[model samples]
Target: MARSVDTRGARPAACGLQGLPGAWRAPFLECAMTLAAPEPATPMSAGLFADEAGCPRCSWCQATPLYRHYHDHEWGFPVVDDRRLFEKLCLEGFQAGLSWLTILNRREGFRAAFARFDAEAIAAFDAQDVERLVQDAAIVRHRGKIESTIHNARRVLALRREFGSLAHYV
Candidate 1:
């Protein structure tokens, strides 16, 4: 039998194999088990957990500042504006193989590299501009996404001309 340390009874006695007295057994055992067990992860994304009021803890969002900000501030929000919708479509497409945090962090660079995501401006870009964008390090340099952005911009422009606005068209 292992004897437990006693410091004027302030410290709880260990619940040995037979367990401590009923008064102390359950609570002491619980505390000991709790201390040894991993704490449950608290949710952080409010939109993900309705019962938690949107602050659902997500394993992917562990501790990165950019990820936390995007998760809390931007995820799941709908867009109705043509320009904004176009921008998000391009961004989400660009984010397909990469992490959203990477895209979020480089968003400003993307805006700069893509001419602020302006539909007309991007639509005006030629092969020369495509080459320039490929050389730019600020944004993701993937050729497919880069070319797709141009194609999408043209699509948006056509939609705008036809429907008076992409919002109404969509």
Candidate 2:
């Protein structure tokens, strides 16, 4: 018979298959395993998981400190700034085949490499800039994505001229 586990409250975050004593880790891992199974025996609600402090959060953000931080601070918040909005557009484009974690981890590098996502500055990027960015290890370094970012920056300028801000454009 399949067993049922109650996952209603906050649980320890040390659910990974590493670093805890066997006795303590076993049950947590079991719970994690149950949640991770391809077809969960029990229906879990809304993908919510409580942190060590007992605050509920999205399940996907429980994997890493960076994800948790992003969940707590940035996720679900409203953004209105044009540059920030444009930055998100470019980042989302870069994130096509990759995980959001990968994009988030390299956000700073992307900012540095892409002129802080300034639409005007990026719209002016030339072939030399594309060559330099294609060799950059910090960002994804896909020539197409780099070129798309530049192209989109120009589009953003057009949108900004028509609509007051990228926020308004969207």
Candidate 3:
């Protein structure tokens, strides 16, 4: 009882970015479209690995130390903390055009640069903050992504007030 998935025009609702304003979400659509497209059919199993690892993981995560550690320690694990959730959101935005490993290596730098991902704090980041972040070497210095983080922080606060928590909202 298997049905095929039509990856074309697939909605990005699953990524939770659908409701965001166009300007806020425009940059992500290309990435979403790329992700939503179906890969060439392969006779492969999704859970191709499991055993002493304690959980089955997607094959892509097997490639590097950072991905493996993230898969085992963080990925797919339930996240309930608001700050961590906010951090992940910003990190994913920063992840555009960059490898996740780059972000992982600079996670602490991001935390420090963004005031530990406090929504209220980030929402209040002035122009000076944006300029400083652009010059920060440890983290990605893309100005647009830095500004998006601040914009998204304000959005997070609104969502939090409406939904009780960003985790709940997400």
- Per-candidate clashes, comma-separated: 9, 0, 0
Residue-wise C-alpha lDDT for candidate 3, range 130-151, written one tens digit per residue: 9999999989999999999999
Clash-forming residue pairs, model 1: 43-56, 43-57, 44-56, 44-57, 45-54, 45-56, 46-54, 46-55, 47-54
Greater TM-score among 2 and 3 belongs to 2
Lowest summed lDDT window (length 10), candidate 1: 1-10
Q: For candidate 2, lDDT tens digit of each residue in 1-170? A: 23233445333244432322333233323332222323445333567754554445679988999997777545654556677778888999999999999999999999999999989999999999999999999999999999999999999989989987889978
Q: Estimate each model's TM-score.
A: 0.64, 0.73, 0.68
Question: lDDT of candidate 1 vs native?
Answer: 0.65
Return model 1's CA RMSD, one decimal: 17.9
Would you list the rank order by TM-score, best first? 2, 3, 1
In lDDT terms, how accurate is model 3? Answer: 0.73
RMSD, one per candidate, in order: 17.9, 11.2, 11.8
lDDT value, candidate 2, whole model: 0.74
Query: What stretches of model 3 exceed 4 Å from their correct place?
Result: 1-47, 50-56
